[model samples]
Target: MAKDELGYDRIVERQLRGVAREVLLQVGSKGLPGDHHFYITFRTDYPGVSIGPTLKAQFPKEITIVLQHQFWGLEVTDEAFAVTLSFSGKHERLHVPFDALVSFTDPSVKFGLQFELKNQQVELQPADKPAPGAAKDEAPTALPKKSETKPAETNGGGDAKPATIIALDNFRKKH
Candidate 1:
């Protein structure tokens, strides 16, 4: 098969990231219910990744974080996800761009996604309008459109009140 000059081979690869992004957005908006959990592996050195010096020193190149019992402040955007996790008794926040992601897995459902390393930054298009009654506090420019991709299905039906707040704090640290 002839490779398309338009980088068509990478279309599915890029869509895979969108799939993972949708999952994270659901988890952020609706806390993981039952046995669902995620294992997100990402490149540490990618541009826009934020990690504490201690954790960065430990996993200098790449790290896998589990989202199961004790994660806080998960904010999902079109291009990236940020969450605060307990590490050595400290709540360390991490920011990882989807383009920088290496893999995402939901072992409980036998679902997983792996992305090829795309060194360049992936600019996110503005997300669709926020759901009705969504908090007005969020700045208009930073929101990621949620309707552009396949909607996450809920067994219970209808939108559930998000159990957690989508706090957008300390997204990236300046060097």
Candidate 2:
């Protein structure tokens, strides 16, 4: 097996994360365009993940958040993004670092990215608390399969297209 002294895999992963970040930055500035929504899955326990204690207790491992409607405070940075989403009528803020993301899916367009999260290193931040007496809405879902965008999930169109999931494992060193 040849040694990847240049760390090509890591480089590719960083670039992919950058792509996700760019998409998010645009959405933050202008909101989701058309029926294009997002299913962002991230590690709940990862460093820099700031969510209310209730949410942490519920989704200890990970969670998938829908970013179509009923969300606010869409802030994006080079490292991470923050937003408030509704989970069963309870509104909670979440701060997820890009390195903690497992996948990003926009089933409407059948475009998805399955990240190879090798670099979990992120700046630690304080846990976020729910707004005083603020009730949540609905969005948080159990971390579904890495790339399961079923035909029924795609928004109204002539025919649903199979999701294209880009996974880096296919290009990684076998050894």
Reference-based lDDT, residue 129, model 1: 34
What C-alpha lDDT does candidate 2 achieve relative to the native structure?
Answer: 0.75
| TM-score of model number 2 | 0.81
Encode model 1's per-residue lDDT on 1-175: one tens digit a residue: 5446776536666677888899889989999988888767677778889989976666666666778888899999988899987765567788999988766767555566655676554333332332223223211122122235232343234543223211112222234
Model 2 residue runs over 4 Å out of place are: 119-137, 145-160
lDDT tens digits, residue span 48-72, model 2: 8999997788667677778886899
Q: Which stretches of candidate 1 lie over 4 Å from their true place?
A: 120-175
- Poorest 10 consecutive residues of model 2 by lDDT? 122-131
Taking all chains together, the TM-score of candidate 1 against the true structure is 0.66
